[model samples]
Target: MMTALLLFWPALAALLVLLVKGQGAKRVAFIAALVEFAIALFAATTFVVAKTAPQFELSVPWVERAGISFSIGMDGISLLMVLLTTFLVPLIVLSSFKHDYKKPNAFYALILFMQTGLIGVFVAQDAFLFYFFWEVALIPVYFISAIWGGARRVAVTFKFFVYTIFGSFFMLAAFIYLYFQTPATGIAPHSSDINAFYQLALDTNTQSWIFWFLFLAFAIKMPVFPFHTWQPDTYTEAPAQATMLLSGIMLKMGIYGVLRWLLPVVPSGASQWLDVVLVLSIIGIIYASVIAIRQRDLKRLIAYSSIAHVGLISAGIFSLTEQGLQGGVIQMLSHGINVVGLFFIIDIIFSRTKTREILSLGGITQTTPALSICFMILMLGSVALPLTNGFVGEFLLLSGVFQYNYVFGAVAGITIILGAVYMLRMFQGVMFGTRSPETEVFADLTFNEKAVLIPLVIMVFWIGLFPSTFLDISEPAVFNLLNIIQKR
Candidate 1:
């Protein structure tokens, strides 16, 4: 079925890539990603928004005695996320075309394999399949960073791997517990279906414990607040392309997991702990923004800024309002686009100037107007300038947070100004100050670079100006989720 192919094609492509020799690996990977994107388009275009349940569903028995099933499908929200995944992946691949990583075949193949896991996470209807894909996505990223990353690659990647694995323990436990509790409607006495998970009735106290277990994993993956110590170092040390994957898409897995898996199954537990999550999220916003203001390394600064941005996104989701959930999805997509552009801009700079220290380089604008202009546009998007993608998402998010609690909403809203201060300050410091020998010869954007950036810029305006287009696609699914949560 098309749904199965859409979920698994990237793994197939990764396999095909291993057979290619030399530069052919990049082409095969690029073309494979392109084809995967095209199929994702087909799935999205075919998805009937009117349908409340999953579309293109393909279910089969797996481990029949244990009642596990291999099931996959897409609802409106999952479909939209599928579109984001498929859409960005090809770009992620193309963005790397200019770099000739050693053993290009393995590097590109791992990307494809990761794509397989990402799509699986989004489309999977069975709890076991979802966890399977979740862990599958982690492996390739570990190897990618450890092999191709900076001088501290081994230590940094090892720590990242261990921390993430530790988080997964909680998730695995939650899923197994859910699996045992599921009452079967089919051949098996129990089922691992997500819908069944949503329908469970349990003691409020039990739900609370289950919620924290699942949340620990999601929180650590998003690396929220105190759980976030590992992120900046990993971001700074990983290769630019791998960093893009981590920031642009991988982080979304945590947010998506919370929205889909956590809240639906334990609405009361979510309600019980909602205040705690919000406080941590808001604290992270101020904490990360303040740190971003002081960071000197371009990678580390943006890394901290990401912590700040996603903090607000997390708060919005936990608000548990219709607008809040909708806003979370919008921010997830917008953040994916904007953050990738920001990192790519950094990559372009480092490629040209050989330094990521914001202090070491200056007046890049004096020489590279095109690069500077793109940098400014992405900067504004990050700071959530009106009429940009970030603006639409943040506005909706703030509105949702306000509906939940005005004081926390107002406190969280500080990111608007704080984000701008840090972002523009970083921009002005790097692109507008007196030129140094390091920056005086800075070159303009290359064709390949432009190919990657122009689309991101287009999306910033398109989604900002007409978010309704994107919102409508996911509205049905999101509202359904909120309705379920409120009813519970």
Candidate 2:
């Protein structure tokens, strides 16, 4: 029941929002998102952290002849991902309050609609069901970016659409092939349940091919190095709210796919390609960091920085250490919080000065002390300051990677230094020095802006001060996943 509500509410709200006129749509959408978040929080209260199997499960035959089921549930991992989605969504919607985009109703409706697909992806327990929601999630964002984004929205969004859809085909192919491999049973002679996939025992050669097919899909979404060509342009070109949805919640879909589907479903294959994937992730971290340092556009720099951050999370997950996986899990939450805050700050800056170019702005702190403080905190979190949220996850991730290989771990550690270099440099350039003409009369954050950032700032400290609150929820599940891999 809870699982179903989490999956359907946003969709229903989206429909309701479509009926609303003018600015009312934003309010309705924001309220709907809040209600959804409350439901998720209430559901969290009923969750059993110690239980490894999915709870609040609901499985129904959706395609009886083909062996598909409309199955959904929450485990520690699915729950965390859902929580992240629900928590960030309202903020994403609320952050849009200041913007008066054309066709306001459709804009808000698409965001709420995207929420449904995102929650569905997080909670889905069936392979085909996961794929269904995975694609469902992409459709709204496609329209959001293409319709409401910057000047190059069409070209940039088309490329993003192509990259994702192209990857989806490979994933579908992989899922279909795996579906056929399942043992005959019931009316369909085979099942698409995730557990069925988990029990598959393909030969090394088969697993190797499956690894690439699946990796290509997940890697492109995570926008892992070499496959990440489409990300910077898309993130920069998308509207602020659209960018938040993509970076904060949508990208996690890829990482979640890797954890839930890729690693466990194809452990031997994952093991086979482990080193190769790690190298690529590490390369992304360094490559993105170097690029970010040279970027003059605040939004673009943060976009590249996101690539670096997720690169570490990807490497940590593939490293297969307890700390690595746990770090990856916690870091997903932290990164989502910090990145959204950073991007929102960027939005605020852009809205005020009509510029995001770092060199074209300066001395914002002189006039906007509150904005400076909030920006600094989010920036510090991004740079992994010791007492901030980013530190906890990076520490555990580095520890996990070190456990896998000291050399790789050492190389990955450079992210901390490089991260600080770029983030601090960005902060210094944007908030200090002589006031640029655009920023000469910069105003402080407005009420709505502070409303959006304060909660994010609070979370940065909460996660930093006591990560165990989240780590405990995911620990059992992480261990369970590792056990599956080890057994394979």
Candidate 3:
């Protein structure tokens, strides 16, 4: 329950700040996000110190008959995700300070509310509670993009909502089916606990249907391949800070769902459909990579790249091996940090120059050396350079795929080379070559900007260089998931 407060405190802080006015409102929001970040850090530290296992912990039952409870707990996997969410929120809030926003208090308040939803999604141990949090998280982001996004905000925001809901309904249906199937419901209806879900044995036919239903929802959220049409518009239209949250933390909600709900609850179904998932993921990676190479807008290019990266993650998960799951989890974290860093640089450039068109931009390194250097490192990481965070995850993932099938591994391996082509081309065009007149007077990184990015840059290198430390934390949980899948 105390862990739950880590989610609520931010909203509570936001309410307090609403009473203040103007710039102070922004400061209050930044402070509130900082406070929440601290609490998350505390929770992470405490969980590790206590040497906790997943506990059926909650303060009280929220809706007893529905099996809905205010339950929340963490395995190593969930805790890492919770930490990532909290870690990024404050940085996002602080980064927004430089922009002149309308109704600063509300903007900050919404961000806090968003945090509550995100944490709720990660920690939720109950299916009904999880779905409730899923919708809750979506709402705040809708407002964030609608109120704070760029020129086409309305259409982009609406598409974002509709696109997610279109997929989410499938998830909702699957859960409803499972809820009724629970023998406790027949004995005398009970709640919908996710942990309880792990124990039930569904017929293969049912598992097959439920698996697709659940996967559809998660895949739409991940926006893999054919389903990814909505991403570019939304990412390009949303404000940079909003984009960071979307790409960095929000997208992980999809991966988390696959881990928390899809894998454990429907292993038989997942195994049956593994090849189908692997095919879609590979297509998305290659398809998006090719498209990204031709992109004119920087944000759009990155958006496509995000789709590709998550595609690989999806493929890794479907591999269904211990190594695959571990790679997927580590890759999720690494992608979150590295992609967010890339987008932050995108935000920095857009904030100063007011355009995302790659053709319109030129050699920024001439003036923004530090910014260029940072972007280059992040780009290299994106391309999975040997010492960067990306390499370790890709290496593990491809290894896992190879174990599954050599053809699968070889096809997935092509992304490593293609990724470099698009990323370096984008990098060389924007950061290196001759300066465009439009960027001629560009200023270097500000103290505030550096403050936001330095930590992310450190993470890129740290994870790249010392992956074992991070991978070790996730091993136990990953092993648990693999065992569940194998048993099924």
Question: TM-scores, in order shown?
Answer: 0.98, 0.99, 0.96
Q: CA shift at 207, candidate 3, in angstroms?
A: 0.5
> lDDT, candidate 2, residue 396?
94
lDDT per residue (tens digit) for residues 1-488 in model 2 = 99999999999999999999999999999999999999999999999999999999999999988888999999998899999999999999999998898999999999998999999999999999999999999999999999999999999999999999999999999999999999876889888999999999998889888889988999999889999999999999999999999999999999999999998888888898889999999999999999999999999999999999999999999999999999999999999999999999999999989999999998999988888889999999998999899999999999999999999999999999999999999999999999988998888999988999999999999999999999999999999999998898
Q: Whose TM-score is greatest here?
A: 2
Model 1, 456-480: lDDT tens digits are 8898998999999889988998988
Question: Which ranges in model 3 have alpha carbons more than 4 Å from their true place?
Answer: 48-52, 185-188
Instruction: Pick the winner on lDDT between candidates 1 and 2.
Output: 2
| TM-score, cand. 1 | 0.98
Native-referenced Cα lDDT, model 3: 0.84
- Candidate structures ordered by lDDT, highest first: 2, 1, 3
Off by over 4 Å in 1: none
- What are the runs in model 2 whose C-alpha is more than 4 Å off? none
lDDT of each: 0.90, 0.94, 0.84
lDDT of 1 at 234: 96
Clashes of each: 0, 0, 4
